[model samples]
Structure formats: C-alpha cells, structure tokens
Target: MASDGSPSRDTPEKQKRKKKQKQRVEDDEEGRSSDGAEVRLDDDDDDDADEEKRLEKFAEEDIQRLTAAGHAALQSGDNHAAVKHFRSAYSYASKLGTRRVSKTCALNLGAAYVEAGNAEKGLRVLQRQGSSGRVADLQFNLGTALEALADAMEFEEAVRSLLRAGESYSSSGNPTEAALALRDAGKVMLQCGRDSSEEILNVLTNSLELSMRITHSETRGRILNTLGLLFSQMSLSSEAVECFQQALPLLSGNTQTLAVVLQNLGATHNTLGEFQKALSYHKEAAQLYGSLGRRAAQGRCFSNLGFALMELAEIEEARESYTHSLLAFKDSVCEALGAIRLQMREPEKAVVHFQEALGLLSRCQDVSSSVQERLVNKLSEALQHKLILQQRKAVAQRRHSQRLPGAAMRRPDVLIGRREMMNSGGNTHDRNQVSTEFHSEEPEKEDYSNTLPEANRNLNNTHDETDTGQQVISSQPENGPGEPSVECGKQMNGTLPLVSGTVTPPPGRHKATPPQRTLKSRFCTVM
Candidate 1:
C-alpha cells in the first residue's frame, strides 16, 4: 500500500490500468462460460436426433431377425422355438412402435401357443388382437382350435365354437374347410328344426368367389371338389356335376385330383343309373389313379366299375375288371367279393374268390352284423353255384367216356330216345372205367382195307401214351340239335356252348336264369 501510495513501480495511472485489465479478463471468462453452454446444448440436440435414427434402424433389424427365426422354427416343426421368436417379435414391435407389425406378431404368437397346447393363452391373445382390428386368418385358427377342444366345453358352447369356426374359415380363404364346416353346421342346425341349405348356399357361393382370387390351383380344385361333394349330398346332382367338372379341368393337370374328380363323376353317373357311362368314368378314374401311383384308389375304382358292369349283364367283362381290382386291393374284402362275382360267369373260379373274401371280411371288427350277413349269404350262393358246376362237369365227363369207339353203353350225350326223353327225372350215369373194347382181326391174310378207326387211335393216344401233360378236348357228344358237320379233328378245338340248346338241364341243377334284381338292399345316401 505504501509503495502503491507512491504507485511503487507505477503511479496511480498504472494501478488503474491493472484493475481495468483484470476486469477485462473477468468479463472474457463470463462470455466464454455462456458461449460454451449454448454450444453444448446444440450438440446434445444433434446427438439425440442421430440416436433416434439408429434406434429405428436397430428396431427394424430386430423385427426382421425375429420374423426369420420364427419362420425357421416353424419350418423345422419346432413350435416351442417359434413361440419364443414370435413373442420376442411382439415385444420388439411394441417397443418399435408399429401397430401393424405388433398385431401380426401377436397373431403368430397365439398360433404358436395353440400349437403348444396352450389354448387358453392363445385364445386370449387372439381375442385381444381381433378386438383391436380384423385378421381373418387369426380368427379362423383360433376358432378351429376352439372347435377341436369341444369335449372340454358345454354342448351348446361347443356347437357355437363350431359355428364360429365355419364363419371364420369362410372368410380366411379356406373354402374347402369352410364348406365342410358349413356341412357340419347344417347337420347341427337341423337339430334346431332349421334347414341350412340357404345359408350353406350363401357360404358356398362366397367361398367359390373368394377362391377365384387365389393362385393356388390345388387349393382351388380342392375347394371345387368339396363343393361338388356337398352339393351331391344335398341331391343337387346337376350342380354337383358342374362343380366336379369345373374341378376336373383344373385338376387334370394334377394326377391325384383328376382321379378324385373322375371318381366323383362316376358316382354321379351311377346314381343316375347311367351304367355304361358310369363304367366309363370309373375306368378312367382307375387309370388316373394308376397314373397317380395310388393302388388303393385304383382298386376302389375297379371295384365300383365291376359292380356297375354286373348290373348291366356284362358278366365276362365284369369278371375281368374285378380281377384287375382284386390284384391291387388285397386288403379289402369287398374287393375280393367283387372278384368272386366276376368269377360267377365261370363258376369254376367263384368258390376260390368267395372263400378269400370271407376270410378277410372276418378280420374286420368294425364290419356291421348286417354286412356280415350279406357276405355270408353271398358266399353260400357262390358255393352252391360251384357245386352245380362240378356236378355238370362230372356228368359231361361220364357221357364222354361212354361215347368212345368201342366203349360200353352208358349215358349218351345225344339222347336219341326223346325229342324230350324221360330226361326230366333221369339220374346222371355212374362213372365206370371198366375198359371194354372189341377189336376185329383179319381172316387168313385176306385183311380188310387199313382204315384204322381214327377215333380209336385218338382215344389210344389220349388214354395211354403222351408224356406231355397236355389236356384232351374230345367230342363230348352233346353238340345241340343243330350240330355243325365238323369231324372229330375240329372237336379238339372246344367250341362255346350254344345258348340255343334244346338240351334239358338236370333235375336239381340251377339253370342260367337272368340276373336277379335286388328287391330292397339297404339304401345308402348315395352321395
């Protein structure tokens, strides 16, 4: 202070100048503090903007990854893994702020929950999502899940679940399922004293129109085929035929579906009693099934065709067709029976087919007592036919044995005593092999011309010599009244029995009567 009084090193002017400089330094420090605060605030705002963009990018990537994982898990048939990813996706979408993404994730999560047997949780999630907006697919799945759990619910509630399921499926691009659901609905609705045809038609129409919007030909064909079946059941044959035809054109490109359509067409034709046309359709169906590599389906088609042909009196053809069917449908007794019926034309083979069919049908515990009765009756009839055929063959063989060149007199195939001999009550000749033939010899070398009875030589060749197991078809002296003038040589070539024979059948033998039309077989819905 004393030095400053004299302004030690300076006067008052120097001291004032130092104070002013100090004040200037203080002011600059204050300005720096304010400017630094403003700059820092601006920088913080820029960082926040950049961080928001990066968060959005990260959120999008998370969603995409979650979706991919969920889909992969589904493809691997791991429902639990899919559920985890779906849940993660839901959480990520919620945080990321996209309502659409969040809803879809929740829907997938619900489906996974259902697949995991967590039905209640899935229902809650789905209901919540549905309340917020609409997702036809999600609703359909939930309703279907609910329907499958009907046993756990009240009867009324279970029925309602089915009803809802039908509605949901209809709106979800699943027309076939929708129609089936509708059919079930109709059955249920009938219990309430209501006809569901009108309602069913409405659903059916909508389903058809909706199916046209999709690109999956298989799905569309299935829907169309289902509609055809449904309509057929309703007795709308024409409509059903149209639907099946529509499906046919589309399904022709797919072997499996084409076979199905052909089968449906055959069924419709059969219902209309267009037997020939039905056989044609069924034959085509069988071929189509073969092309599609379905042995069972081919067998079924052939069986149906055989049944149709039999009714049309094409027994020989029916037998061949049934034989073809039996080769493929080895497990089905019905198919075996069909083959047996075919063999009915050649009664010799009937017994074998009938016995095989009976053995198989016996194994099926689900077979109804009525079906068993029918099978037994058919088997009995086939056995009876076999017996008659055996008896006829035996009688014919005995007569043939008697007719040879120098054999003893027994029954003659050609009854000379009667244009109507007392044949009606006559018994068949007993088979006798007491080889008795008289041969004439030459007289003192003045031999007769050598015309060694050709018939005798042939008989000798048949009865005694050949090492080969070749069969002999000799003249069975029974060529009917208008016998052809062929010699014994052509007799080796067996001729078909003449239907216009005046040859009377034996007393108790069943004759070839016309086909017996069934009076009242149990009726089917014929759908």
Candidate 2:
C-alpha cells in the first residue's frame, strides 16, 4: 500500500477481508441504482403509449364532430361556416396522421370554399390533396372550381378541366356527376361563342347519354330540358322538340318545370311552322302559369299563343289572345297589337297602339335604339296608310255629291248609242269622232278630270309601293284614233317621277307601245 500512492488503511490479511466487504457494499449500491432507473423508465414508456392512444381517440372524435358540423352547415347554405368547420376537421385529421380521413376532410374543405364563391382557394386545396390519386369526387369538385373561375381563365383551360372531371366520374361509375360535368362543359362552350356547332353538339350528346342512366325521373327531366334549350339555341329545332317531349312526361309531377317544358315546346313548334301543336302547348302553358300565380309568365304564354293563332290565320282568336296578354301586363305586346291592327286595315287603331308602344318603350331604361327605331317606322307607315285612306274617302264623297240624277239616267242611253254605232260598221275616224262628241257633249257626266289631279298629286307625295311594283294612280281616258293613251303616275326604276296630272300623247301614235302594268293585290300580315 505504501509502495507509491497512498497510506494503507488495514494490515494485509485483515485488510483483504475489509476490502472484499467494501467492494461488496459498492456493488450492492450500484445494482440498486440501476434497478430503480429501469423501473422508472418502464413506467414512463407505458404512460407515453397510453397518452398517445388517448390523444388519437380525441382527435378522431373532434374530426368526426367537425365533419358533421360542416355537412350540416353546407346543407343549410352557410358556406362560410362550412368552410370553417371543414378546415378544423382537416387539421385534426392531419394531426392524427390519418391519410384517408385527411383526404375526405380536404375534399369537404375545398367544396365549401367553392360554394362560398372562393374558387381560387378551393382549387388550391383540391390540387394539394389530389396529387396522391385520381378521385371522382375530388375531380368533380376541382372541375366546379375551374368552371367558377371561367371569367379568369382561357376558354380551352376551362373546358379541359371539365372534360377531365367528366371522364374521371365516368370511369368511377358516377354517371350522374359525369353527365353534370359534361353538361356544364357544353354550356361553357356555348357561352364562349367560339366553339363549333358540331363540337358543342358532341359534348351535349355525351351528357344526354349519361343522363339516361339516372334513375330519378325529375333529375333526368331537368337535365333533358337543359339540353333541349341548348339545342334550341343552336338552331336544332327538331332535336330540341324531341328532347322537350321526352322530358314532359318525366317532369309531370313538378308543375313549374312542366310549364316551362310546355312553353319551350310551343316555341319550338312555332319555329317549325307547326302552329296547331304550338297553339295547344301555349294554351296549356298559359293555364299552368295562371294557376301558379305567375302573372308575368302567363302574359308571355298568352303572347306566344297569339303568335301561334296568328300563324294559323285565326284572326279573331289571335286578337283575343293578344288582348289577354295586354290585360295580364303591359309589355311589348302593344307593338304586336299594333301590327295586328295594321294587318286588319284599322290604321287609326294601329296608330294609337304604335304610339302607346313607343311611349312605353321610352319609359323603359333597357329599350334598345333599334327597337325604338322599328316602332317609329311602323308608326310612320300607319300614318301614311291613314292619309291615303282619308284621301280616297274624300275623293269618293266629292264624286258622289257631284253626280246629277239626269246625267245618271242619260248614261245608259249614251252607252247604248255608242255600242249601236260601233256595231253598225262605223269607220275608225267616225268611231273616234263619235267618242269625242259624246265625251264633249256630256259635261255633267262624272268628270274624273277634276278629282283625278288631286288624287294623283296625293299619291305622288307618299312613298308607299303597291304589290304590282308600281303605284298606278289613275288610267288615261280613251283618246282619238291618232292619239295613244298613257297610264298616270306609274313608277320607272322604282322611282315615281312627278307628273303634271295631265294625260300626254305618245311619241308615235300608230307605233306607240305602252309598258305593261300588272295590277297585284297586296295583303298585310303581322310580324
């Protein structure tokens, strides 16, 4: 012990025994400390495992509670509240490390954002969660977000997203959603007004095909009706009618929808010139609208009914229908009524109606200049017709007053004498001289010369055209054998030249050839 380090505590033998005892004591203390540490470590591990399970259970419950609230909020139309609840659910699910529930919550969050009109936010949420897989619901919500962003996106991008959504739904056995997505795509194309008709048709047709798989009659009917309207806008009247007819029976339980289908059918049939069918459909639609207390819609239906009746030539029925429209509401039907009146030759009534329409239009803020211009033109036309009719009446009244009883009695005898002279082999010169003497002698006879000039002047002042392509005011009286008679106020090159209202001789008597004037009857119809 004293060899180099420290002083010895005991002798060699006794010290050996004492050293063994101290070593034993040190070993016992070390073993006891190790055993205590092991026991504490085991207790800590068990507590942590139990705590993690408890936290996971709480997180799952919270996620479920939040998801339920989000769904309830969405159904109640509180999209903002839905977004809040869904966002919390998503956070809880993420914290719990649940991939499946996390995805579900993400989808809910995105849909809530979309419904809230925050499409950009929804799109970002969906894109983040959609990276893992191709999900039908996810794709559908993504498409909706894209469609809502249509104003901010190019047409091609908007359409491509919708198509992808539709395809995904189709592959995932969700025909209804697929159909809706495709239908939306078709609507986008139409609204863009840039796609070809054929392309739009193909897209709509695919939607229709998918819609046929739907078991719910009302939903299918609505889809079909929407497609029908799109077809109508594309000018596919035949296909549109077919679609409307198919939807009519399916949607019979829904009164408003049924009425709309009937109205559409009526309009399409009218466009196809099937006025008889159109009249029936319009009547049914009008009655439905009346029952529904939709006064404005009923008025529109009656107006459409009037158009159909007019096309069928049922003038009285058409007029009655138009009156019904006017009673329901004072709309553009006034102009239509004016047109009908014009067709019936009631120029005074037409003028009144036209003026009323112009006044009504003036009061409306949305009236276009072109519409006002057309109404003004119609009023001018009615006025011109009224003036012509007044002139004719005045001329007829003057002629009636100027006629003498003696001249009327002598007219037959004069005509009989002229006929006898002509039948008795009179020479051309003698016949002409007799005609001249007869005309010169009968000064009291109906002298058209005085009234003709005024009538011709009035005719020349108006810009109206006859159906014959020329406005013939009056015919010239028969002239002598050497002179040729000419028609008065006939138009050449569609232009009416001013004349002195006097009959002029032809350039060459014997060889004079007059232009052939064909008299045609003109008929006016409602627009």
Candidate 3:
C-alpha cells in the first residue's frame, strides 16, 4: 500500500518489465568460457563504456574549472594559488591524453611558477613538455624562466632565449610582446655590463621598431625611455636625446613618467653642452617632482638645474637653485654647494659645506669608501685654498699699507711714459709689448709684490664674468704633482684658458687666472 493511502500500482506491467530485465541479466551471466567461467555480454560492455565516458567528462570539466581559476588568480597577483591550480589542471590534462590542452596548461603552470619566483621549477616544467618550437607563448615563458635563473655566466643563453622569443612573437603578429621581449634582451645585456656592441644595438633597434607599431602610448613611451637610458649609459648622448624627446609627449598623461623623461632629456642635453635646453627641461622636471611631493627627486632635479645654470654663467640663479636643493635634501646638496663656493673663491665657506657633507656621508649605510675619500680630498683642497687666500690677502694688505698714497696716483703716468719711450724708437709697439719690455728692463732686485692687490681683486671679481670667460668648476681628477701649470697669459677669444694646476703669475704682471676648475661627470638615475 502507498503511504498516502492511494491504491497500489505495482501491477502486471511492472512485474513483466522486472522479469524481462532479470532474464537478460541471467543470460548475460550465463555466457561461459571453456573452463566454465562466466563471461561478459554486450549489455555489460555498453554500460562499462558509458561509465568511462562519464568519468572523462567529469575530468574535462574539472580541468576547465581549474584552468579558469588559475588564470584569475594569476591576474589578481596571487601567484602561489595560480601555480597550484594550474599545476592540477596540467596534471589532469596530461592524463586525459589531450595534447593541445595539456601544452596550454603546462605553459600557464610554468608562467605562474616563474611569477612566484620559483624559476627553477618553472624551467623544469616547461622543459618537460618537450620542444616548444615556434610557439610564441611557450617561447616567451621559457625565455622569462631562463632569464630569471641566469647568473653572470648564463646571461648569453638567457639573451639568446629572449631574442628567439621576440622573433617568435613577431612572427605570431604580437608586436607589443615582441617589443617587450627584445627590450628584456637589451636589459639582460646591460645587466651583464656588455659594451655597446653590435648585438646589443641590433636588439634595441629591433625593439624600437616593434615598439613603434604599438598603439598604446604609455607602453611605447616606457620602451623609448628605457632605450634612452641604455644609450645614455653607453655615452651615446645624441641617440639618447632623440629617444627621450620622442617619449616626452607620449608620457604626458603620466606625471611620474613624464617627469622622468624630462629629467633624462635635461641630463642628455647637459652632456651635449646645450645648457639652455638643459635648463628648461630641468626646470619643468623639478616643478613636476614638486607637484608629486617627491622631495628627493625634486632635490636632484634642482641640483641638475643648478649645474646648468652655472654653465650658463648665471651665478646668482645657480646659487639660489643650490639653496633650494639643500633645503629639499641636505646631504648631497652640501657637496654641490661646497663646489659652488669653491668656484666663487669663497674657500672658507666651501670648507664648512664640505665638512658637513663628509659628516652626513659617514652616517649613511652602504656608502663606498671611495666616495668618502673623494670628499676628504675636496675638504683638504678647500682648506689649502683658504690658507693661500688668507696669506695672499695679508701680504697685499701689508704692501698696500707700506706704499705712499701718491705712488698709486703716479703709476698710470709712469706706465704711459714707458709706453711713449718704447714708441719713440719708431716701432709702433702695443701697450702689452711696451709693458713687457719696461718690466724686463726693471732692476731684478725690485719687488713685484706691488701687483698682488690687483690679482686679488681679479679673483674676487670672477663672479661678474660672462659665460664665455667664466671658469667651470667640476669634480674631475686633479693634475699629478709634477704636471706643469697652465700659463695665464695664453688667452683665447678673450677667455682665460682653463688652469689645470696652481696659478703662478710672472713678476710685475697684475693679471691673474682663477684656480683650477675640475669637470665632474653627471649621470641621470633611471626610475
């Protein structure tokens, strides 16, 4: 009876169907071999086939699910979860004898492992799948894994893999990926500290060509910026300038990247000796950095700006720029400010700044000893310069006090009389020649210390000089102890020749040159 009180429905129709089914099962079980053992029938064979198909369908579904989950995790930056999921998917796909699906799964798994920083495991998994051939994705992931595992010795292999991957990607019509792969190859070469060899140039050129075809402006800009940095490092200033300039407009929407491009342009122009262009670009970069609230970067920009300003002989503006830099970050700017003071012949002030820089540097971590030694040398030079200036000033003061007031009033007439005497010989000698001859005939015992005050005045008034006549102070290597000093009388285009060592004027000459100025190399830091 039914539980709901309905009439029972197990009639003859159901009984007949059950009997037929039982008969068929018994017949299938009745089949036997020669040893009288039961054998399977067609009906049982059909059932077993359906069950296998069902299990296979379930496995395929699981693979699809896991693969989707892996991709999602990878995109979300959950590398470990992506690796686990992809690994399971790859295992299932492998057992299912689906060669194409399994290859895809393997590539995904390998990429996930690489992103997780397990490059060794990624490499093993990728290699285990056999030859990748012309498969772009497979080749790219393989290259990435190889590069991640590369050391100094294996860099060549990594570069080769990346180049191959780039070619494969290009052939597959993926210009963006191709450009990225080539750029990676270039970076690997740079990391190995390779010279600007033909191979490196070719790789970077190919990357630039590929990047040109990309529609994404920021990506292209970034690639150009990277190439510019590489060229700059290799001393290819012209090429670097071109690359940075091209990247500038493309990166405008991104302030940080735009600032970097501007800064790089400024540095490259500075290297090319285009101070005007450098000044403009550095000013723009500094402004951008200020807007971004990046004090360190802003300070560096201001420092570079000060360098350009100094080159333009804008002494006051340069000093102001250095002051801004010092306010932004106190350490590195101290050294630069000290260099400026030294150039201005304010050695006392230079000494103080250099000492402060040295003290700050000592407190910094991971600072190289050579840097500190350089600072020490600069400090020593500043102190020596200060002492020399003081001694010269004292001697000039004493001689000034000893001289009669009427002697200064009569000096110009005495010089004119000597020039007239020289001209009386009917040889129209210039004033310079007359002065030279007059001094040559003077008594050898006569003291030439009378010209010291004039020379001192020239040194003090150097800041008023024009760009064409101004001295450039840098941080370049000083002359050796035995090197001959530059002659101050050898002027070019109304500009005093650069002095490479101590200045020593000829007797009775009032003209003097400023102290030797060094040339420091400036480099732009890539962010």
Candidate 4:
C-alpha cells in the first residue's frame, strides 16, 4: 500500500474510508444546518437505530389505522371493503413482527372474508394464523365459514371444522360457544344419516351439560329441544317427552319459541301413539303461531294436526286441516301424492297432479329461494315421469294401431293420428284451464268441512270427550252447509258416512256414544 502517513486511495482500506466519507456527507446534506453548512455526524449508529424504530412505529400506526377502518367497514356491512383493509393490516403487522396486532388483524380478515361469502379463503386465513389467546373466537368464525362452505357442499370438511371449533372453545374456557358448536356438530352428523350415534350422543350430552350452566333461558330451551329431537330419533319416547317438558317452561316468553316447543311436544306424543295429547299440543301451537302472525308455522301445525286427527279417525276434521294447510304446503302435498300415484301405477293421475302443482307454484312468491329450488326440482322429476308415461302410452297405441290391419291404408292412418293428437291437446288444455281457475280463487277461504255427516256435524258443534278423549269444535261457516247432512254408515273408518237425517247402526254392532265435554278448540298448553 502507498501512503502519505495513511493508506493509498487505490487500496481497499482507502476505498472503504472514501465510501464512508461520502455517506456522512450525504447524510449531513440531507439534514442541512440553517447556514448552508453540513451538520455534525457524531452518532451515526444511534441515528440508524432511531430510523429503524421510527419505521417500526409508523408500521404499527398504519396497522392501527387499517384495523380501525376495517371495523368501521364491517359495522357498515361493507364486507369487501373490510376484507381489503384487514388484509393490509395483517400484512403490515406481520412484517413488523407484532404478534398481537397480527393475530387481531388476521381474525378480522377471516371474519370479513366469511361475511363476504369467500368462506374457503376465510377458512384458510383462520387456519394459518388462528392459534392464539383468541382461539375461541377464531375457531367459531372458522366453523361458521366452514358451515357456509358445506352448504355449498363440503360436508365432511364442515363436520371436522365444527368439531375443531367446539374443542377450541372448550379449551378457551367459553362453555357457551363450545356447547353451541357441539350442538351444531350433532346436527351435521344427524344430517349425514350415518352411524354416528355415539358421537352425536356424546356431543349433545356435553352441550346439554354446558347449557345447563348458562343463565340464558332461550339457550337452555334450544339445547333441550335438540336433545329431545335426538332422543325421538333414537325412539326413546319417554326421554324425549321429559326433555320437551323441561324445554317448554323455559321458552314461554318467546311466542315463536313456545310454538316450536309445543309442536315438538305434539310430534313426540304422536310418536308415542297418544293422539289426543298430540292433538291438544298441535292445536295450542297453531293458535300461538296464529297470534304471532306466522302463517307458514301455523300451516305446519295444521298439517301435523291433520295427522293427529287422521290417527284419531276424525276423517272429516282431518280433511279440513289438510285443505287449510295445503295453501302453504301445496308443493309438498302434490309431490307426495304424485310420488305415491306413480308407485301405484297411476301415471296419468300423477302427471295431472304434478302439472297442477307446477302451475300453482309458478304463482307462489312468498317461499324461500331454497324451497323454490326444491319445488322446481320436484317439478322437473314429475315432468320426466310424465314424459315416460306419454312415451309408454304412445308405444302401446302404436302397437294397437299396428295390430289393426290397415286395409284402407293412408285414410284410416291419418284419421287415427289426427284424433290422437286432438285428444292429447284437449286434455292438456283442460288441465291448464283447471289449474288457472283453481288459482284464481282464494283457496284459504274455502271450507270443505260442510260435507261432513249429520252425526259428525253434531260432533263439531258440541265438544265430545269419549273414553278415547277425542275433542272437536266448529267455526262459523262461510256460506253455511253447502248440502243437507246425511246419516252416517256404521264402521265408516271411525267416521260417519254422509247420508240424510238421523244416525243409525248396522245389525250386529251397538251404537256406542261418548259423553259430550264442550271445550274451546284453542286451548292453551300452559293451562
């Protein structure tokens, strides 16, 4: 190295010193003094440290600002905007190595993704960054997102996610969330319809225990209801009844909840072959639903009530309940009947019912999108069945036409073909017209109960409590009785067959009459 009491500029040492001097000069210029002179650079190391600290602090401030913006967006229901903000916050907080901020931002990001319906993405975000003190909240959010994803059809994944959520919540000491998650898991397991009975029982048991510890009556009621349903599924009628009874008292404050409890109670009693009790429960539920202005729920209660009535052999009353409930559940009714008719080898009647159902469904605007889709799918199946029937009929007709020797050739052939086409077209037109006409009328106001036998009419007018504990109450008729009542036949499936005037029995069997006990139809469950 060359030197003038120092290393030469060409040497590595001299070159390093020159670079340092240039950097100091640049730094000094960057922070110039008032007199246009370079500032003293005594603590270069300290300045670098200060600069790094400032950068970290700025990053933290940005994360805070972003997180705040995300919350504001979430509160406004602008999920997409919230997701964007949270994503940015998460990135900044992560880069700065701030665990608390990063975790919070990540949680926010996942929830925003879920709210935006990007469930898979949300689940991924939570899974990666969700193992912290707030595990309970994160897992709950994850489970909910998975649920949404599963509804889009990833059932196994959703089940696993919900189980994970329950465990996480339990570990985090949040029994309430843990119980809810476990309950959801049981529901999902039940939906799968597999042999997961033991798992379901375990989860439901844990859920029940946790729910009992909570002070919330509604939550307790819901847990008890779910347990009752599970018990019913297992055919443990006594246990189911006990659970339902326990739930009923807790759910009294909420009309809809009380109605649901009553309906379940009715269902349980029906399963136990207690028709009268089931009828009583269903009637109470229907009245509650009516008071709450829940027509759909009321309709369901009526349909269930019809089932109890049929079991009790109250055919006339059952028919009336079925008709009333049909206003809301026509698609289900038609679909069931169409399927039954198809099974019975009555293709033509099945096709007619299916077509009528579709036409009526086209006018229904109050159903949920999911229900509408299901109805449309049923209609499609019905159309396919109708097509198959038509094809079979055409084939049979062609075979018959072939068997009849065509001596007159083209003339007879043309006449037969034309007639077949005309008949088919006419039938279709008639069915469509029937559908249109039926739709035009207010079906809810129509009462077919007037057609009951005179004996049945008396049964309707005065409450009858026989040894069988049957009860009946009649409402004011819209147009009074349409036709004069008839005397009933003996052994008419526990109903009096309609004929004119007084009741009479068959030769061998005696007429067994029950004592009248007039009670209002709308009896309260609480009373």
- lDDT (C-alpha) at residue 481 in model 1: 12
What's the residue-level lDDT of 429 in candidate 4?
62
Question: Model 2's lDDT to the true fold?
Answer: 0.63
Better of 1 and 3 by TM-score: 3
Q: For model 3, what is the error of residue 179's alpha carbon versus the real structure, in angstroms, after optimal superposition?
A: 1.1
Clashing pairs in 1: 4-7
What is the C-alpha lDDT profile of model 2 across 1-527, one tens digit per residue?
67777886676999888886776677688875425657789999999999999999888888888888876666565769978998998888888887878888887788778778898898899889855344756666666677667663555666776788789879888777677778767867876777898998999999999989988887678777767766766667788789889988998997777877787787677767787988788889888766654443555567778877877789898888766665544534566567667667788998998798777656543233545666677788678667656755754764664476676767776667657756786655764564465457448543222211112322322234422211111112211110111212212232122121222221111222334221110001111
The C-alpha local distance difference test score for the whole of candidate 4 amounts to 0.59
Going through the candidates in the order shown, the clash numbers are 1, 0, 2, 4
lDDT of 4 by residue, 76-125 (tens): 65768978988898899789886777787777787778777787898788
Q: lDDT by residue for model 3 over 1-527, one digit each (tens)? A: 79999988878999998887777777668763333223346667789999989988988899888988876665565779978998898899889887777777787787778778898888788777776433666666666677677667666776777788789879889787788778767767866765356877888889889988989887678777766765654556688788888988998897777877787677667767788988888888888766654444555567778877888889999988776665555544576677668767799998998799777765543334544665677788678668667756754764665486786777777668647766774454453464465457446533224222112222322234344212211111212111111112212222222222222221122233324322111001101
| TM-scores for every predicted model | 0.49, 0.55, 0.54, 0.50
Pairs that collide in candidate 4 are: 486-499, 486-500, 487-499, 487-500
Q: In model 2, what is the error at residue 344, expressed in angstroms? A: 45
lDDT of each: 0.51, 0.63, 0.63, 0.59
Model 3 alpha-carbon miss at residue 114, Å: 2.2
Give every collision pair in model 3.
474-518, 475-520
Q: Name the runs in model 1 displaced over 4 angstroms.
A: 1-39, 115-119, 132-134, 151-195, 212-218, 331-527
Superior candidate under TM-score, 1 versus 4: 4
